[model samples]
Target chain A: MTDRLSSQFAFLDEIDRLKAIERATPIGDNSRPENSAEHSWHIAMYALVLADHAGPEVDISRVIKMLLLHDIVEIDAGDMPIHMAHDAEAHAAKEAAAAERLFGLLPADQAAEFRAIWTEFEAAESADAVFAKSLDRVQPLLQNLAVGGGSWIDYNVTMDQIDTRVGVKVNRGAPRIWQFVRARVAPFFSASR
Target chain B: MTDRLSSQFAFLDEIDRLKAIERATPIGDNSRPENSAEHSWHIAMYALVLADHAGPEVDISRVIKMLLLHDIVEIDAGDMPIHMAHDAEAHAAKEAAAAERLFGLLPADQAAEFRAIWTEFEAAESADAVFAKSLDRVQPLLQNLAVGGGSWIDYNVTMDQIDTRVGVKVNRGAPRIWQFVRARVAPFFSASR
Candidate 1:
């Protein structure tokens, strides 16, 4: 009974700590923030869809685990785009702050587990983490392209920038998916031209 | 590469299909619509913090998997609370509809694995599923008591009503946790009088 009651305390604490989605975009004319919850779901889909072309012998289950938890810290530190143009130091600070607040929600042992997964993802050194990162990058690229370069047009994004941001994602994670992106999505860049 | 990708898609599809968190609060509040993503994270904490009390040896790893994928269908069907006072048909219809849409998100085989985990949870037939469901029930009861009758106040819920709702939960899952709930939470009802 003591345990059951404590479980809820842990649950509620985590909920309170999840970061609010702050990315805003105009759908037609209205703008709204994309909360962390939505971002997590979208990334999971990218992981699911792109699982086939992952790096060799990848334990996708671990990749799924990492992807689900990696951004939870974003709830505390807040999200910054890869190109949000912050130096590594500030990036480290923001993610580090987020890591402490978010992981702190769990009991000591569980918090350690979650914190480890998040850290592993940040390093992007492991095969699983790298695969997960690829999906993270690819999902947003697909979203932007699907939205007809919605954010790209809004931000006046250039093709070179998009390539730099999402290109290596293909090189590292799944070469096939990257090729598809190039063939299917490259036309969009030229069409915009 | 293809096998890993397809496997993830299959699991994701199944997770999406399960109508895990369709349970809602008695009254309509946006909060009742707590996403599956939120519920999964909450339950993972339950699995982690309260693992010691579970009767069966809990594979924390497997428990985490179940918790993470449990209520995916809620993504499409939205959350439905347990005490909404709906007919059996209406309730079943709501969740069933949600299951179809949510699971459909994944490619194919991935959907089946997710669906099985969800089924295991709803059945309470498997050890892992039983522990997972126990945690699910435990988390919210604490929240309601912590917030001084949370949705209870909003919906004008009575002590008897909460007991009845929690009764089925207690009988089916963790006995120890159930006993604690009765002892600690019953006082809340008595003190209110």
Candidate 2:
């Protein structure tokens, strides 16, 4: 029992570093880039509030779990901005290694459970995984759109890039949110042209 | 449908303000005080990680919902430090009102669901609520302990006060954690004396 508790506490201690793992998305105010922990929380809140908009067949509980645990690997891999990370192959390799070391801090059963969940989310095949992916993409997009496209402007992220990279997955899971995003966010970048 | 989506989005916009509502407890590094959103996120992660330590009868999912929404009211009421919020009556009134206004931003069903979850957490009567309350108190306590008693030293918080305010609830829900806290945390303060 003591050994089990130690493993759990060790994992908890490791994730405290997540608050320092900054992401590309700014807060709604554009004061600073949101940390991965805050991003996970925000999108989990989104899962709760906006689950109704997801496919009717999706399980909201599983979606919430996936969102909560999806980014734990980022603590080890460091965050890669979607627009900035050039080599997709290297990114995948780094994250896979990170997942092994970070989740490995947990007791055996939990490490396996979390690893499985992370892999499932990465696959994005199941309905819950699809909706979870949608929430993940929509959150940064919302933050970007809310702050007049902070990352979008900074990274020179074009709408077509966002539509292709983020919107496509969002559309697959929650078409209504994608519709809302296109209607509201498209105009800001379009007007700049 | 648009109007419903509008209400949901409006609520999301309001909660973005929570990132600015700082709490008394610092992050594990003692660098800066954690914000309500981060606090909520951390504790929800705790629920997932520590649920096995909770009483066998407690429902982990319900506890997670409580921890997530319990502090959403803080976005409106402002965080009253556990050791500092003296006028409990006024604090309760303010938080109740805040709960109604903030959660009310959701569509009727979601609003009611959130309100009920928040109320249940406040009541702390059920097994799930008791366990949720334990996780809530433990996270900050762990934060303070991890950073060599950051808030405890800053606020001049006493062992008796912690035992009364936080330890009591923590004991009811997760005695093993409370045992861990007492053994580890008491030494830090005692050494200073």
Candidate 3:
């Protein structure tokens, strides 16, 4: 029954309480810490700018919608870094709960629409989601590279770990980009090895 | 000169910082926070949902673009609430400085485009800018209503103040909605007074 002007909602204050939850920042110029909002915007841009890269069958606007709403759950569950030593399963549980609470902020209709998008992003079953996920992963890697290797250095990250973290995604969205990453990093690691 | 991807750029931790910025919630649900990223998304929806109400001559997509990029500067100067006891002149100074630092994040072409949008929104001269501003103002009132008189009660906000905050925006964007707000709130306030 409620809408954008429900007048009885209690979460207004709590909504203000939410903070940007992002992974730890590293030192460097090429690197920039992306906020959840910024991350969403960037992903949306990917849908716009990289539409050609997405499978021709995918609906880019849907992918954009997915990216923009994907992280709303971090409002409650908090942000976790891709390179964290945390348990993946536990993080998933927290995010799921957060999604329910955060998206519940909207009126029933809007909430349902947003919830569906977030859920689709999580499912990653669709070609669009798959492609979006790749950009999500690849963007951070490039950011680290730009910043002269950020979290990668602090964690003593190796090429193998980077590949797993980023490779799987690129493979799904753009195998060519994945191949490019593989070709670039394997040599540096091989020489070190 | 430094550009979008800093070959030696500093602020590698910008991602987390931005996340923190985006997650920082405002006083209302419908109202866009001072964050540039969320502001973009919120405004897009406004353009769509209120398309019927928009001036016939306005480009909805252009309006959406203006909204999305309008607030990227809060990344540097931070958010200034509409009702906060702040100096309007000083805030303008702070924002100008922030715009330079924040929008400069994108590559040159993007930076120019974004800065122009931000400027246009601030100028409020264009139809898209006017409509975007209207949405910005209306969203908070809707949020306060939705959250059960949220910031309205918390701030002991007055009818005169609320009217002034949203009056022009509503009139400009959707005269009908403005009329609806006046019809709903005017009598209630007079009686309460």
Candidate 4:
């Protein structure tokens, strides 16, 4: 029991590093780039508050859990922006390894549960995972929109890139939210061009 | 429908301020004070990773939701530390008002749900809320322990104060966890004196 508790504590202590893992999107006021931990919190709150817009099959509690656990991999692999260019296979391999190492710090059962949730989120296949993935994309879009094309401008992200990279997944799970986001996002692209 | 989405977006935008609301506790390495948003996320992760230790009646999903919403009131009322001197009645009134205004920014149903969870967490009456409240106290205690008495030393906290303020509640919801924490925390207090 003592060993189990210690493993859990060590895992928690290690994850504190997620707060220092900076992402590309800034906060609403754009004072600084938001960190992964807070982005996870905001999206969990997004799951809670905007759950009504999710697909009928979605389980919100599970979606919230996935969102909270999703970016923890960023603690080890670091934040990779959606618009940034990277070797997809290498980044995925690194994230998978990071998930194992970090989640492996927990007692066996918890380590498996967290790793499964993190994996499910990466797969984005289940209804809950799909909704969770949508939210993962939704948050950064909202941040970018709030800051008048935040990372989009930073990376010279185009409308086609936004549609292919962001729109398809969010629309798959939460079409209404995607619709709302599309309307808000159009002005930014038009003004940029 | 558009109006509802706007309200929800407004609420999300407002909560970006929470990332700016600093707490008394520092991160593990003591680089800087932790913000309320990341703290909420960390504790939500704590509730997830440590649910086995909670009382049998505790539904961890509810506990996670409660933990996530609990400190959002701080976005308005601001963080008031456990050891800080303040009027209990006045602070409660302030927090109540803050909850109403902040949660009120959501669509009506979401506002009501978020407000209820926040209030339940404040009441600390239900099994889930009790566990949620316990983890809330536990995280800061761990942070303080990690930093060689992080805020406890800064505020000149004594062992008795820790027992009365932190131990009792954690023990109530999770006696085993409290026992673990007690053992880990003893050396810090003993060394300080």
Score chain A of each prediction against the true chain A by TM-score and list the results: 0.84, 0.96, 0.82, 0.97
**How would you encode candidate 3's per-residue C-alpha lDDT over A1-193 as one tens digit per residue?**
2235432133332433332445553322434455565556655654554455567878766776677667767777777777778988898899888877776765666667777777778888888888888877766665565456676776777887877777876898877656654665566556653
Residue B18 alpha-carbon offset, candidate 3, angstroms: 8.5
Q: In order, what lDDT does every prediction score?
A: 0.62, 0.86, 0.62, 0.91
Docking class of 4: high
| Chain A only, candidate 2, TM-score | 0.96
Give the least accurate 10-residue stretch of model 2 chain B, judged by summed lDDT: B184-193
Superposition error at A78 for model 3 (Å): 2.0
| lDDT string, candidate 1, A106-126, tens digits | 566767787888888988888
Q: Say what the RMSD of model 4 is.
A: 1.1
Q: Evaluated with lDDT, which candidate comes out highest? A: 4
Q: Model 1: DockQ against the native?
A: 0.23
TM-score of chain A of 3: 0.82
Q: Per-residue CA lDDT of candidate 3, range B67-112, in tens? A: 6556655666676667668788888898898777765655566557
Model 1, B1-193: lDDT tens digits are 4545444444443443222333432111234434455456556655655666776566666776777766665655555566566576775577667665665555566566666777777677788887787787766666676556766666666668766776566656677777766776788788875
Note the DockQ of each predicted structure.
Answer: 0.23, 0.66, 0.17, 0.84
The 10 consecutive residues of candidate 4 chain A with the worst lDDT sum are: A184-193
Ranking by DockQ: 4, 2, 1, 3
Write one digit per residue (lDDT tens) for candidate 2, span A49-156. Answer: 997898788988788888888998888788888888578889899999999999999999999998999999999999999999998888787788788877888889
